[model samples]
Target chain A: MPPESTSNSRQKTMVIVGILALIVIATAIALYAKNKDEVGTVTENPAQTSTTTESQASGSTVEYKDGTYSATGNYQTPGGTESITVKLTVANNVVTTSDVTTSQTSQEAAEYQAQFKANYSPFVVGKDINDITLSRISGSSLTPRGFNEAVDAIKSQAQA
Target chain B: MPSSPRLRLSQPFSLKFEAIGTSWTIEVYEAYDRLGDLQKSIQQRIAAFDHVYSRFRADSVVAQIAREAGNYRLPDDAAPMFNLYQQLYDLTDGAMTPLIGQALSDAGYDASYSLQPMPIRSVPAWQEVMTYDGATLTAKRPVLLDFGAAGKGYLIDLVAQIMVQADVRHYSIDAGGDIVTVGQTLNVGLEHPDNLNQVIGVAQITQGSICGSAGNRRRWATYHHVIDPHSLTSPKHIKALWVTAPTALVADGLATALYFAPADSLRRYFEFEYAIMHEDYSLVSSPGFPAQFFGADS
Candidate 1:
């Protein structure tokens, strides 16, 4: 009778421990699911922000009409104020051709004009060759000099 | 002895003829009774030059050299011309070479004007295949030598010398677009590579020669006369370039050199002024290059 009573107390304690362990495991699972949901929301915010930023960039972008354009700009040089005319041809919003004409009012500016180098721009217009009376033309179509000093040297060498 | 009467004409005396597959004009301010003699002499000189240098001609000295490799005698005038070519070849690191004749012909610029491109072989270096010691050009193998780069300029200088020897004080020679002016300053138009009817700018030449090289003309199938051997393709970065030097030889040679190297590099070896037009139509000129650009409004 004493042995039977002891077995009954031990069974009661085992049942209590198993029920407490199940409760603790259920609470830990619930906290883990909540944390997973929060993590998912945090990652989604950056994707939303990236999409909005890209749309804003597209809205602010400028598109240019394809055609020829010309403008004149003036800048102060050491000599005086010099005006330059720029001509450009734009295609697909990109400059395809450019030409710059410098008109220097002061003689000093004119002297240094040769050093002026034009960057790639959209200026594309120029005077027609037919409109002007050119004394001569330089190109492949017309085809066609130190030579004296070299010749003199050659002649003297031959005589020697 | 009675001298020939020098007739002061209201207009300059001019002679026009066709040679070396191009038109040539020789103009002088004063007319001479010996104009016919002068014309004959000029024709003979050009004929001799063409006979010796023309690779298109089967009987040309260059063609003979192409047939077999050996030591060949070149003309006295070849000294300065060859020297210039050697210097340019060294300077450009074989970018500009006379050995490009084979490449040019292979690209369809041949004696028969085939205008058909074939498989191109890399051009052998000048040092490897041949040796040019002033007068004698020794070739190790049969190589086609092309003087098309500055030959015309050298010839122009030679023709000018002929004129000077003839006692002509003021003269201008135009072979196609290349012009040499003496005792006068002439306004020269720089032709637009894209549009022949218009000019991009104007330059003044006085007692100097101005020569231009462009990709617009003499081009076929994306290949122009100027070819880089390393790539075996025509240079397309530059649309056109013009060089002005005391002699036409320097101007003409440097015009081709500009396609490979910068103006500052060539200026170190030769005294010349240059204007380069990039493919985008951007203009770059030397500080002393006497040129004026016409904008859209002009």
Candidate 2:
């Protein structure tokens, strides 16, 4: 074989090996990052977090601030004092979704709270925060008042 | 297979709201994470049922069936309802008929709630006009399905079935007056049609259903909504009737049937406890019914 031809073949082999090395390195980095990301997610899920436990024990769960807002509220009922926690997702200045959790000492109160959530959330879902007018929601008079308070807190936080 | 998710609700719980244009109270022992979802589902089911059975809506399936002649495919969930309806029809000797819708419209309790009976046509015997062969519902002639007697009660029963499937052991569903109680013994007052807020009797039961029929609330001009299918006029024989049975559907149908059937003839249809208020201001009750009249109370 010609000396120049031999040298060119050797260079081509070296280049192919280098390209394979780069591909392997890139794949390793991607797989490591993905695993790390999965670990982070499992460790940081809000529902399973210490913060969530603390807030739940204290009668509320607050979460999701970027484009979403959460606040804890208190209300008075014939059964005494109870707490309500609301998490709202906002898009285009309108409330998109609402998740409400009520911390009540009585099963009856909790059930009432669930009814309030089902009834009132629809009216608030697509409305702007400034226009929310709470009313007597399916005999759940107190929860609506608490919802108003929670909305007020979210408004103050978002400046919307 | 993945094990079913467990819902760890403690003690007794209740949920109250409105649907199908009436108040409803639901009490249950256990609730789940998806209780709100279940409530929404129930609301959707009721709305869908209303869309099919509502005579008020011009576009409802019943109204459409009345307008468009010939055989039509029944909705999937309609088979059981038709069976129950047929049983009531035969048991009541055609008095508790789905064929009464036209007669009711003629008497003025119409889809428009105009409260005027300008019935375009008279309703004949339901068995003669309609035929149901399990899968298909055919109208031999133009007829309307009122289903007013048992629809609401059947709906309550359907919802109860859903709750039962979700592992709910103790529950009570009170839709306006028609009630279904499970695992709770409740004392129900039988209302007098002529006397407001005055009950002629009271009944108690657990794991059973009760429903009452009266012309007290829905009356217009000189007529009440409860029309006798045969005469096309409200039956004055019994002013009000309440029945208790294994399910709300049967209880409601039996209450309507009592308006037509003689007191003794009812034993052939089903076993239930009932109370009837006669036109002469007399109240009679089954031996098992827990009844104490206002004047009879010592």
Candidate 3:
């Protein structure tokens, strides 16, 4: 009878340990789940930020209004404040023809300005306004410098 | 012996067009102004040239080679270009990889600027199996060629060569952003990549070509045209690079390699001038770089 009671007591202690082990494991799992939730909430993906910007303003796919828009891009060279007057004619959400006339400057400057006028018109002529990337051709180190700004200014006006 | 009056100094004639999936400009300072001839000739020349190298065109040599990976007898023109490529491949320690074609397609630059679906495939490291003899190109493994880095500038060099061969001096070939001058000192402003309209500095070139490669343009999903092969990472350090050399081929190749190499280390292999914009928006230039560079805002 003494031996049998001792055996029963051992079984009771084993059952209590089992219950305590289960409780410890459940608490550990809850903590892990809580930590996972915090990480997901706090960590913001870098990729998400870039996509947000592309969807809003500078995207080439934006369905801009078709109309004539004009703007001036201002820059400062060593000489003085320089400006290029841009007149854009948008048709079917694209800049069909652009006229860029620059304020007077040196001979090299005038050539670059002329080169800009020659290029600025055709680059945006046919494509969807949303698809146009002015940086596609950033112009030569010497020529076609200020043309992109004029394009951006005109693009702002073309935006519906 | 009087020079041809048409070859004398005259009002600069200009031509602009879109080609190779980018903008192109031709400026003639003091030479025969054959804008009409230039328009017809350049289009035909570009079409023929693209048939061989353009990855976008499925029928191109590069595309066909990618589709069928094996030994191929390269065309006559491809020899010189490939020779330069092999030299560059050796110099950059595989950083300038010609075998990065498959990676580009898988990344989304497949054809016509269309972005393919995700789960981008890990590109095979091609330098291990690809081989190029003097005239024959062989690949024991699959290799696709994207040549986006120096090909446009090479094309500009070829076009400029054609003009020079035609005895037309004082002509400038601005194949979109790459510019080569024959007989004039053109003062050019380096366009700041961060601010497209702003100039980083001004450079005066008497002759030769000046080419700029910027990461600010031609970006999609997670890829820029310039990819580093060893790391298989995106453009992280260099934002923009400008190189001046005797030809567009050298200038263009060096400009691309500059992205991988520090400007000081490159002095041993090649002699050229360069200015680079870092990822942090700071500017670093070679000692002999003939440009008046600007800092962040000033």
Candidate 4:
């Protein structure tokens, strides 16, 4: 073979090998970048962490007193104005009793009052108010929503 | 031959079967032994029960009794219904009266829905019509007796008994919103009163029953169905109420009764152990109520 042709063939082989190496290197880099992004996204967001901390802090404090507590919110079911007036009596760190003096609600809302009296009032009687989530009732939804708003209002008042 | 996936014969056969005028799913590990025979027997038993209980069927035993008695004498076949009526009468202080059947009919519910507007009328005091003579029941006035309250639960109890006799262990019998579970625990979602699709709470129940009572959009305008005997009108005080107990019958009966009873009286009645949701968006539970049934807060 001629010397020029032999030299050209060697150059072509080098170019082909170089291109293969570049392709492998690019694939590895892409895989590494994709995996790094996945891991980063799986980490919890800062906002969620902060909110959780706040909830935990709120859950640990107890405040009880003899006073009237008011709560306002919108009703989900028979949509209308919602408000509750609770006359609270507290002895020690527990709420001794709470009487719902006034409630402005629709007919459907009034029906749930029995359930509230039956299910929720007793739980708040003797515990440190901080340990209870006023809204957690297994069957009653509308009444608990109102009761939770009332509880939040009471808690805010206590903090103030 | 290439080995196929392991044939796990021990695994329970979970199958959905439609019977009792509705659909139900049955799960049983031992169902494999006589599956075909058991299925046939179940279907037959459900059909028989439906034939006896269906108010729509003119030939049903209930309907026949209602026809023959002519609003006065109690039919022999209706003795069980009469017993339930007596219990509800005592529980609700006559608020949950079977005599309201005619009133409900007058309000446009005659076995089917009537879209026409109905005038709100006072429900007659149950004492005006119902009287008992040791074993026989007599109605002085022409009153209707609708078994919408206790019928579903009674049917579930019967079906559960049959299933147990057949050795069908893990199963749940859900009739409309009433449910009874046996052998295995069931995670049931308590639907929101406003939106049926949304679930506000979940209850884990094993070997018990749960019933939900609420005024849906269907009965929106005049809450006349669950009437309080004292007011002779719908108890506008309660929007929705759900109760769980050892039996669906008691839960259902109490739900209807409590929805109409005075708040103080109702509270005293349920002092034993139960959960109640009032209309004002408040929830109350008895000391014996189970918190574990409700899932842990997120």
Best by TM-score: 1
**Chain A TM-score (model 2):** 0.33
Residue A46 in candidate 4, Cα distance off native in Å: 37
| lDDT (tens digit, per residue) of candidate 4 on B83-125 | 6667667767677876665556555544444423365355666
lDDT of model 1 at position B227: 92
DockQ of each: 0.17, 0.01, 0.04, 0.03
Predicted candidate 1 versus true structure: per-residue lDDT over B175-223, tens digit per residue: 8788898876778999877667667888987689999998776665557
Error of 1 at A9 (Å): 86
Write the candidate numbers in order of decreasing DockQ.
1, 3, 4, 2
Runs of candidate 1 exceeding 4 Å displacement: A1-118, A121-125, A141-160, B1-7, B296-298
List chain B TM-scores, each candidate.
0.96, 0.89, 0.90, 0.75
lDDT of 2 at B119: 51
- Residue pair clashes in candidate 3: A60-A130, A60-A131, A61-A130, A141-B188, A141-B189, A142-B188, A142-B189, B24-B176
In terms of DockQ, the best-performing candidate is: 1
lDDT of 4 at A16: 28
What fraction of correct interface contacts does each candidate retain? 0.48, 0.00, 0.07, 0.05
lDDT of 1 by residue, A92-132 (tens): 43334555555778775554443343233222334567666
Instruction: Say which candidate scores most in lDDT.
Output: 1
